[model samples]
Target chain A: MERKRASLKFLVTVMSNQAASTPAALKHTPLNATHRELSAKMVDFGGWDMPVNYGSQIEEHHVVRTGCGLFDVSHMLPLDIKGANVRAFLKRLVANNVDKLQVSGKALYSCMLNEAGGVIDDLIIYFMDESWFRLVVNAGTAEKDLAWMEKMNADWDMGLTLTPRRDLAMIAIQGPNATQALNHALPGVDSITAHLKPFNAAAMGEMFIARTGYTGEDGYEVMVLAKSAPFFWKALMEAGGKPIGLGARDTLRLEAGMNLYGQDMDETTSPLESGLAWTVDMKTERDFVGRAALEKSEITQQLVGLLLLDKGVLRGHQKVLTKHGEGEITSGTFSPTMQQSIALARIPLGIAPGEEVEVEIRDKKLKAKVVKYPFVRNGKVLI
Target chain B: MSIPADLKYTPSHEWVRVEADGTLTVGITHHAQDLLGDMVFIENPATGRSLAKGEECAVVESVKAASDVYAPVAGEVISANADVESSPEAINKDAYSAWMFKLKPANAADVAGLMDAAAYQKLVESEAH
Candidate 1:
């Protein structure tokens, strides 16, 4: 038993180091050469050598807010689960209710939780049919999430066939003109995607197009063959979709009040406290993993949006002092649209919107106001 | 990318230009701004504040991350650039022209101890590898 435990500890260390590997050992997406050709500034993001920006990250962000921007999101894993029991399996696998997904191609955003009520990863589940489902998970947590799903599959005796779609590459075309650029790029995609609403997907040939995005904008997350990524990227560019990088992606998401996996929450953070309580579907009688723990857990903290009133920029891990208690900023960035700094903080409960809070930046405490998030959506500033 | 031969540099990437009046104008290097991506905010040390050599006296925050600007030599800050603080993107436009602060060095000769253009260029190259 001691030897087994020692080997388990070693395995955990090795797995965690996958994203901390040296630059030489970093992984590359299918569009690595394309990014290099575009003169993109590359950085080690979750062990993947990915582009941070082509030029000004703020400009790229504004482009996404106003016009069309293309992003190579191939690093995120596309997992397909197929079986007669696929729906049954997912009913207990994730926190959200799968029953809401009666219509085919409908997508549901959910948080997969551990037995301890901690979030494993937030993912988008697309119901293709009663027998098949597709899930898009975060890049950094792909391996561990897959392992967890595989373990649960066996433990529950659910004989579903899980396939990691590494052969596919995803591109997110976002902004107000996203659909126009997408239709221009693919020519006939408009006919298929024109009627599709948000949180819906459609498959044309081998490509999967979902009308969903991380940035709170009108966009589609299109998946194509990995070998065809560069061609698709070039086509999108020719169709007036400017290539955007991860740096802009981050700022855009923060302004949109989205949670990043590692930054906002992790294996130790519960979905209740991570501003994902709405996605947790506790009203359903269907039993899911972590439901018991979530039922018994006392909610002490709640995630809220903060608008920095001071001149400085708010950053992650900064202390947030509220009248109720102290909290920490999970994700923070300068919202180019608002021309102000915004952040998401997990503070003690009872700090209502419109209340003032102090965010400690270095030695000084800057004033910030608690506000309802989604700071910018579809080029409009809400707060 | 542009390391002016007349200017001096610190290992931390701050570039110092000695003015005709024996004062020094300081800003981040072009390479530093390139690495930090788009500029968002800047905080310069208060004017007349005494600083030690290599003391972190200013801050330059880009969209990607926040970095410190150290005092190249023991000095008193004479002026802070309000223009750059208001429009921090000026640094990305031209790092040398968007000086963050001015300092009256305790010893003007201390500028000679900092890295020259060629030495700083070499240091930046070495760091990239």
Candidate 2:
């Protein structure tokens, strides 16, 4: 398997000399100082100085799954689109049908694709009105997504105003007790958020709280003004909400069967082969950017889940030895919830669940089992 | 940061306990576990395996990544700690007490070449800056 050179791989390497020489070159989130005060281990995550963990990543993962944990996800950008032709523009821009989001606070997950049926970025769109839609995009791909959208807007003459909300800071409070913790942290929020369902959001004062999270847990992704973030983070911590970092976030998302954009699927791979075919709307005849290419191409590989039966931790770039052919692990981690190593591998078709495969870890070939994932959900092990 | 004064140390962060039998019990220091985070898996060298000084013999994996645990000095592996391999979190809980492997040193004088607590502490402080 070919290992892609990304920040995730270098998380373990200590670059003390480089950090000393150019400390100011890295970008900081609003809670950077607070993270340092909390003694978080900060790392360079896609040029952003983000916390990998405050203490134990496994503890943070358990806290998010069992109790309450807060994550400073401000690195993710929220873009606001406003125009009379917004809905029409979205239909052509995204691979999923935006019309499905009828309720004002409802959200839809979609992949923004390139012309050759490859994924550009996977984002969440919140429908606020006929003319305005809010999009939350990944941190590393925010600028690239904006550039592509701008080029498309110019070509289509949509007259839409794309406003990137860099002035906001996002905090994800997740767990089974997340709602109660949020109530403890920011009293009287339940009045506005009590009835909120999955994929729904509400505006309370200046904060936009969404009942959504990357971790497979009940939580809210609250976006507040950048200046108010530190105070919000402090309040949450005071309410017994542990501060979780990106290390736990990666493991949580991987166990939840969610794809990491750069690791799982990128500009070179389409959603069909990336275990995201359900999100790609093909039932109705709507021509999106990559629709024609997807129709013309043949999908040969499939993304599936793996459970290591042996005693080693599964990791990205490991080669998979399947009966049909060779495959590569896209995202892998030791699942704190499952107490075992789990991963998502792109393998050939016809590989069914319950089948055994071998993953080459270092010099040893470890036994593993193919399984359907979301290996964990809502603090419970599924497969 | 708790480097027991009596125990010897290696620059790579392994701590050694000189048993009554002159055999050495070795484990990664507390600082090593702090940097590596919670231990999820550990692969120790076989009991009979012989090792050279500074040879990478065992593997220790945390949730974030894996690391190599090297042999502190030239020695034959006297015994491996089975407790650590099955329950790796013991190392995170008490790094000093949860030993990884015991080694029978080729020469007792080789342990003298390793760092003392005071010298290892100085090396750690320098790395911090």
Candidate 3:
């Protein structure tokens, strides 16, 4: 607990500090004006002027888990890969097997790795055809991912054209009633999306709707023309979709046990230690970019979920003391659904689930328990 | 924006209400809670703890982050408001009314040394820009 006695002063100081920094222009999503109209508190997130919340983040979080909530996820880049050898290029480029995606509109979650087995970015690859695939990657890492892909294309001599669709806007509507809300908003959408399974997608006119989301709930990530985003958002709101923001987005994802690219894993962290071993296809003899490095490296740390047994909210960067060794929290928050504090920590491998550990909060060490993740899914607490 | 004219204030945004019994009541201002947003946890100074002026004595955590509550004027912490500790949201709902601790001032004149409501309001206005 580093006492931020001057924290109120610090907030003012930070705002003043921003003046001294090079005032690089922040990018805006297509729904920027709508967010302002809704009285959203906007913040600079990875150079994008995105909404952190409408008013109350916790209330917005409940709206998503219980009813329906919409998020403007346009900052996430969508790249369309088209060529005869697109499948071949992806199989070599990503850690997961692109060969798994045999049917059209099927999605695969994979970590695009560096040669050193570090995660460059985690992405969702949607196979449209043998010659075409679409990848949705983290906003902050989009440039680096594209550069890496271009490098790989040149090196492999694969004539795939990677087209970044910046002309599009994406909105994710999520919750238990998401599908119904979406159907109500866009009549006849139920018929098209009804048969779609998890991790599947379909095209409806100019829109590409994926039955996928960051929040652990039934939803669609719909990509539409940028100009039509405002109208689409309004329609969804009218159909009972509450406008959620990034603050709630974070709490929702953390409760779902999903990994955030920057916090849960980064360039220096291996997927093996980052709770992403499943995404790394070790069974296949097919060599990928980081195959040799992953095979050669030994995993020392493992990511696990934690539930605080005592008072106090858990937060990122808190130190953990276990019998085996010390660890650190990757991401932590008070789960609005659980009414308790939960965290994902990277600790020594020997620490198994159900074992008790101590987490340092402020100066006091409080007791906590190691548990499996996905703490809450489908409005139910799992652990 | 709602600074009680009767209370004294600190540059750190804490409010001090001088009680008739020579004990002083303390809490964060409404402006402080508004800036912090959505209080989740609060740790008040333990009862009977002696403190110097401006000491980092208590802690208030919002969903966004944690912040320390400094002692406005040096005193002995006579009692802590357990209600604020358990239901931190009370502070966010009404920061001025949700007092954190009762302090027995070491020097009663020290309360006068702190800023009046008008001066504190001016400071807040300056900070906003």
Candidate 4:
């Protein structure tokens, strides 16, 4: 297993080297030049040239947990669906209940699934009005999601107009000091955002601000015109927001127990086994995509959190040995806030929290304990 | 970034420093630490363990991923650095000073065949492109 892991690493290195040689083929975000100006280390993330870190990824992770950090999430696609039947179209498209979003500026987290109950993507849907609803989808799956939604619109005769908002840029300001820094950056905007609850959004002309974030902290995901992203980023920095790269963003989300779209659940995995069952609405009588398959499928595996008791760091794709059967880690990392290794693993059922499991890291089988996740939130360790 | 003139380096990014006691100190190069980002965990080879040339004898894991540290030459591990195990960020601070282990070369002539600072710098530059 150790040798296999080494060979896989070598293959990845070769692929990345090839990608570096042809830089023009990679996509760049709106803040690409800004990241370069900050001397960030760039890497090819799903065909997009993204900043992994400026310097010391661990330090950047700490800054987000303790203070304020800003992230450029412009790679994610924010789509607008318009027409008279927008809400009806969404009810049949997503697995979650769209009726729950009765109030304007409310958001619902849901999984768009294939007919076989496999997740195509997990997205946040923002309801603006009966005829206008906005959705934020993953960057890597943007094109596929649009095609699927278009096909559904035509087949269902919803006659909705789906517009992919590529002309906009998104920035997430996160941490305990997030509100204070944002208020300082954009004066008087606090009056609209201060009362915004979690999973709620508010629109100020073309600019949209949502009180939602991947990191488990008080923050906002603000959207603006693509041309003004650099200026907004600079203002946020002047207001005491540190530039955080994707590396720290990853650790923070993992510590928060948030599921990364591709890493945690892909097109081959179902929401029932990916710790997203709550997001899937089965109590309603409304017919939606993938509902029939979900009802028929028997769940044999479950996603659980693993805390390494040994010294080595946990990593994805490592074998997990439980008493029931073998399992695999979906997302794993060294938690900067907890100062320990934590992982989300898809293990066999019947393994409860606090049970012991052996994770195969290289040549050694290290001891780990199953625990409820959200390992760290608001700079506090939960387990 | 800093490839000391007095030290030798391997293509895999391990740096070697010859000591007055005839033993050699082994650690990763500055360029290696810079590429790997922040170090969070390290595992060194056991003392007295014999290693072949280019053998994967140690590990240096950053927060992002884990990387294998190869033995620079055929040697036996003399001692491992306990301080680095407890606080791996020392390597990120100064890769040269925070040596991972001490090795006694099986053949002293092997150290002479290693690349000098100028050659290692050229190799790093080539890899960057």
Top lDDT model: 4
Candidate 2's C-alpha runs over 4 A off are A1-23
Error of 3 at A274 (Å): 1.0
Could you give candidate 2's per-residue lDDT for residues A1-383 as a string of tens digits?
A: 44332221132235332233254788888998999899888877898988889888988999999999999999999999999999999999999999899999999999999999999999999999999999999999999999999899989999999999999999999999889889988988979667999999999889999999999999999999999999999999888899999999999999899999999999999899999999999999888999999999999899999999999999888999998999999999899988999999999999999999999987789999999988999999999
lDDT of each: 0.88, 0.90, 0.89, 0.91
Per prediction, fnat is 0.27, 0.29, 0.29, 0.31
Q: Which ten residues in a row are the worst by lDDT in model 1 chain A? A: A1-10
TM-score of chain A, predicted model 2, versus the true chain A, to 2 decimals: 0.96
Indicate the TM-score of model 2.
0.94
Error of 3 at B18 (Å): 2.1
Candidate 3, pairs of clashing residues: A1-A362
Give candidate 2's fnat, 2 decimals. Answer: 0.29
> What ordering of candidates by TM-score runs from best to worst?
4, 3, 1, 2
Q: Which candidate wins on DockQ?
A: 4
Q: Which stretches of candidate 3 lie over 4 Å from their true place?
A: A1-6, A12-24
Q: Which scores better on TM-score, 1 or 4? A: 4
Candidate 3's displacement at residue A111, Å, is 0.5
DockQ ranking from best to worst?
4, 3, 2, 1
lDDT of 1: 0.88
Give one digit per residue, the lDDT tens place, for model 1 in B14-126: 88999999999999888777767678999999999999998878888877666677899999999999999999999999999999999999997888899999998887665
Tens digit per residue, CA lDDT, model 4, A1-383? 34534421343344347435565788888899999899888888888888888898999999999899999999999999999999899999999999999999999999999999999999999999999999999999999999999999999999999999999999999999999999999978889877999999999877999999999988999999999899999999999999999999999999999999988999899999999999999998989999999999999999999999999999999999999999999999998888899999999999999999999998899999999988888889899
